[model samples]
Target: MQPIPAKLAALAQQENLHFLLAVESGSRAWGFASPDSDYDVRALYIRPSAHYLAIDEGKDTFEFIEDEWFDVGAWDIRKALRLLRKSNAVLLEWLRSPVVYAADSAFVRDLNTLAPQYAQAAPLLHHYRGIARNALGAMDLHGEIRLKKWFYVLRPLLAARWAVQRGGIPPMTLAELMADLPPAAVAEIRDLVALKSGQAENYRHRLSASLIALTKTLAAEVAALTAPAPPAPATAPLDALFRTTLQRVYPC
Candidate 1:
């Protein structure tokens, strides 16, 4: 393991937590990372079985933030599975992120297999739209805008569009979403992406008509579409997996 991920794993081990899955989650994982972007490490962990027997359930999250190189946190597996059932877009992104640091292939495989079955368009659409809208709020129509906000907004909008069109989980990286954009917009995006790679996070670029227009158009389309009411998933399978994993990790 690389130094950063090794540190994350060792930290978990010290805490007596079993790391079920760990991967990059933010701009670094999204493929448009600036030279100084934070390495946002996210993971799902399983606690020792004895910890679950206590009357008070302990906190289910761990967070550590230092420099841009190592901003790390994790969700307990139980919390992660609950969020997954709700089709939480952030958790879904964690599962789909291309930069995995540590994972049990079987555990990752089971969750990936179940993701499509439980994922619904409504929650994901609402989640991504909120992200895009927030990003747009940070942008200026006629003045200098943070170059990073474009990716922050456009990436989620593109994911929402893909979910609306295809009714599935969108890919985690911005580059994957770029394939669906118009050629002119794509060109502009490419230039911005290149700039982001070389420049610092505070770097600002002049707002352009084409990028703004594209963002508005996609936002409108996403707002118009209705999320399909997906059927409730059978929880028995998830329950079994949860119990099985807990036992596997902390067996007698």
Candidate 2:
């Protein structure tokens, strides 16, 4: 681990937050980082057993930004497990991210084993649809658009399509989604990505008509599809894992 990851780990421990999983979760993880991309570190942590026994529930999330380049946030294990059972797409992506900073081996192993069992198309599709819709809605006026925003919209649109057609989470990277895109759209997007790669953040470009049309059509199609029923995950297993983790991290 580099200094950034090491510092993040130390900060978590200093707060008595035992991190079970930590990984990259944004543009960098998605394989389209620009020259000035920020580090978006997402992690899952657990408090001491005593903290869990408190009369009042405390904050379930922690956020720290040491500088413009380093932004780290985490969810407590209890909150994470609850969200996982509900097929929260963000948590699903966290588990799927390829860049791991620090992780408890057994905890990650168990989480991966449980990920597929709880995978559901409906909530995930709904989630992606919302993401795509927001990104599209936020587009700048008169064909001018942030190149990165195109990816923000396109990825979720593709993810929604993947959920509906393939019945699972989509690949985490934009390059992986190219095969399913129209030839023109893919080419345009790749060029925009290359352009963005050489530039700093806040880069914008005139939207190609073809790319705009492709995004609008895909968004419409994804929005029209019926969301499938979420899978009924077995609660006992998740419950057991939660207890086991608490015990392991705060043994007497």
Candidate 3:
């Protein structure tokens, strides 16, 4: 198999994209990958200037699956910036992911500087709360759940808690989120992670009473949160960045 970076480079060439950034955007990046976890690679790319000016612009996103082990997706730069303006948590997490496979340093740095300005309390809290609630809803009546679902629920709940307490974009990894958790809870989560690392994706485990209780408690705390949706940030900066990036990447 080709190395991931080489594969990504080839993909960019095929699509005629300037791949600006690529990173592990799923379990591996979140620090909870099982032995068989697929590399969920995501990227941001820029098209030639003419693509944006065309009356009928094509798809702004790309996706490909390479066997069962590599799942790749990318968003065009304009689409990414548009989503970023709305405080898209997924995009924010991608930028913060520690397992970057490739990057244009200037682009990443500029985007990172601009991202925090657009990240507001209400949307981020809402995003994480929804994910946690949905994951919790997947549990059976007896609290039998996939081993992976535990991390699914816990990570988002912790991230929601972090947004409320920390007032900025939360760290992408579970280990970082665990810092605010109680020692007992943290220890339990560590054991769970260890178990998950050896298990397959569909492995099932009965949710422990303590974990169930913690889940409920965190859910309530998150549910109780109320923040006014702040007004959107000015788009002038994003507009300028987009123009500058286009000029830089596709200059005549």
Candidate 4:
């Protein structure tokens, strides 16, 4: 479980990937996992200088999948930021994950310094809203409420709350986000999680009508978060973060 980061780092280097940033971002990062949950590993890497000289852009990203057992991918910073600006929550999860296996310590340390500069509320709100809607729909339609669907709904809502509190991107883990909510809210989340424990993989659980109602309210909360437009047409920060971080961390 723990050595994955090192293995990923080694993979990147051996493949001549200009590895920059790496961290735990999936079930392991989230804290509570089904005994059978797959390890989801994600990272960002770049190409060598020669590859950059070519006419074609390097592969935009890399993907490796192993059934439902493991998934590891690397995104070009551009791809990442586009998703981030569109409210990609996974990126936030990586930034906030407590279980760090590997990191360009200084690279992450520096990125942390700049996180707030680009942490706008509007994009994140829109992102969370969409995410909650999708999860809530599953809960509403499934009749048998999926034990996992609630977490999907809960994670985004907590993320929205975190974004609101910090005026920056929020961590995605249920536990980390709880600290930003009221004590009562924290208790509520814990109870719900415990109630759903046997459900990690069941994908079917019953949500009380009250639970459905709460999920709806989360949608409204997502709507409340909105961002001001950038001064000019601009790219999502994911690219710059990737390029600079990679160059900085993996010097030629």
Candidate 5:
């Protein structure tokens, strides 16, 4: 709905970025944005075939700012693949973001079709480890109720569950996480989400029973997240596929 998104989309098109998808992926998307949160726009696109063949080191990601409150970033197709191999959840979510500024190609459609074949277990491990490390620290050090600290902990824990349940890597969001929790844990997460959603920073959010119950459930899930991932499915020639999609999207 913001004009900023439209401007950024135009910039991406001018650079021959061939937008495949774009979406809000920051504090706003997470539902806890401050009044002036930056429009964190992300997109994927293809460059000309010549750009691919005459490769400098393939830069996987790029950023730009059309103006204040309106910045943008893009990922190259090959760069996206490299991240996909390692299970980058942010990248996966970008592929699935709810907002759409500009998307005028079949490139991501083609890539999504190939995703099932190539997405593996290695990346999910890396993704969860980083999530736990980053948020667990905040939960430990921040005041018991700091910035809805529980979401940081819960997000990664549930995502780990999702990976195990689905038998392959899938992207996660807070909205979807609640339905899958044990009743008690769900209550705890709700308390946290309610506290965080309103942008409340109570020095101490005390939900005595709920907090304890949720942490226990999360601890168990964390263990599974650290456990070895199951094997990935067979690979097809994604390079050929990428090229074919590129030719079709980025003509001549």
Candidate 6:
């Protein structure tokens, strides 16, 4: 964690950007990181006010990937807000991530407040289902499967279930999403997590019949769900927040 905070700070300085929020957006944040898992740091930043005013808007993203261990990325605040308006799953997860590397408290607070208002169940359900389908597709149901990849399929299947049943944004952590599962399913998932924690990312093992069964059940249930599309939220509030953030970060 020491290296990460310093790295993020250096990134902020190097890019001359004001970081509004930064957090672990991958396995570490989701509470299921293997011993060798790398940091997936994601952030939202504000460029100099003049950059926004220029006729040619500069790049809105920053990415730094060092080897296979440290991966850091940031989205300019304006770009983040536009995605937020459409309830982007990645942005939604970032706002709820358990591990924070950096933050402007007020900005993060305001953004979280506005998140639920814009989040629509249908899109999020679709997003999670797609993730599960893709991950599941990569595995061999009758043969050996990448053990770690099981989580990739399970997490989103459970998230889709959570979103459909709860009618809201799903919790970011897998443990939270498992709270309401039947005992057998929970036990199987726990065993898988324990095995995954000590193993390398490419570890392979026979797929658990029960776990795969549960995955198929949950996937079918999510696919069958029909949530009404939520009404579009007005952008006035987001616009105000954007303006206010600029003023707060760069008072003139």
Number of the top lDDT candidate: 3
- Model 5: residues with Cα > 4 Å off, grouped in runs: 31-36, 66-70, 191-195, 200-208, 224-236
lDDT of model 6, residue 70: 84
Clash number for model 1? 0
Q: Residue 142 of model 2: what lDDT?
A: 52
What would the per-residue lDDT of candidate 5 be over residues 1-252, giving only the tens digit for each residue? 458556765676677666666778765665545454568888777777777676476565778875667667888877777666555677776665656676654666766766665555556656765686577665653235554555566666666666655645455456665667678766656665565555533434544665656665675566656445546543355676667777777667
State the lDDT of candidate 6 residue by residue for 1-252, as single tens digits.
457878888878898898899999888888777888888989999977898898897899999897688898889998999988887888999988999988999999899889888877878888998999898888776688877687888889888877778866788999898988899888877887888899887888887777768778877887787778868768899999999999999987
Per-residue error for 238 in candidate 3, Å, reads 0.7
Candidate 3 residue pairs in backbone clash:
none
Relative to the true structure, candidate 1 reaches a TM of 0.95
Error of 2 at 243 (Å): 1.2
Per residue, candidate 1 scores C-alpha lDDT tens digits across 73-170 of 89998898888888889999998899988898878888888988878888899999898888788777567878787778889889998888887889
* Cand. 3 TM to true fold: 0.96
lDDT of 4 by residue, 1-252 (tens): 437766776677677775556666655677556656677777866666566568887777887675677677788655665665544556666777776656667657655665555566666766776777777765564376656666777777867756765666776678877785568666766776665554456656676665556666666766666656533324545456666765664577
lDDT of 2 by residue, 1-252 (tens): 257668876887689888899899999988778999989999999888888888999889999888888888999988998998998899999988889888999899998888877878899898999999898888753577777887889889988888878876677888886777778777778888788899877887787667767877898899897765875777898899999988888885
Clashing residue pairs, backbone N/CA/C < 3 A, model 4: 77-238, 77-239, 78-239, 81-238, 122-226, 122-227, 145-205
Segments in model 4 whose C-alpha atoms lie over 4 Å from true places: 77-89, 180-185, 195-200, 208-210, 230-252
Residues 1-252 of candidate 3 have per-residue lDDT tens digits of: 789999998988998998889999889999888998999999999999888887897789999898899988999998999999998999999988999989988889899999988988788999999999898887762656788877898899888888878878999999999897899988988988999999999988887788788888998999898777878578998998889888998997
Q: What is the number of backbone collisions in each predicted candidate, taken in the order shown?
A: 0, 0, 0, 7, 1, 0
User: TM-score of every model?
Assistant: 0.95, 0.92, 0.96, 0.79, 0.79, 0.96
State the RMSD for candidate 2.
Answer: 2.0
Candidate models: Cα lDDT each: 0.84, 0.84, 0.89, 0.65, 0.63, 0.85
Give per-model CA RMSD. 1.6, 2.0, 1.2, 3.6, 3.4, 1.4
The residue pairs in collision within model 6 are none
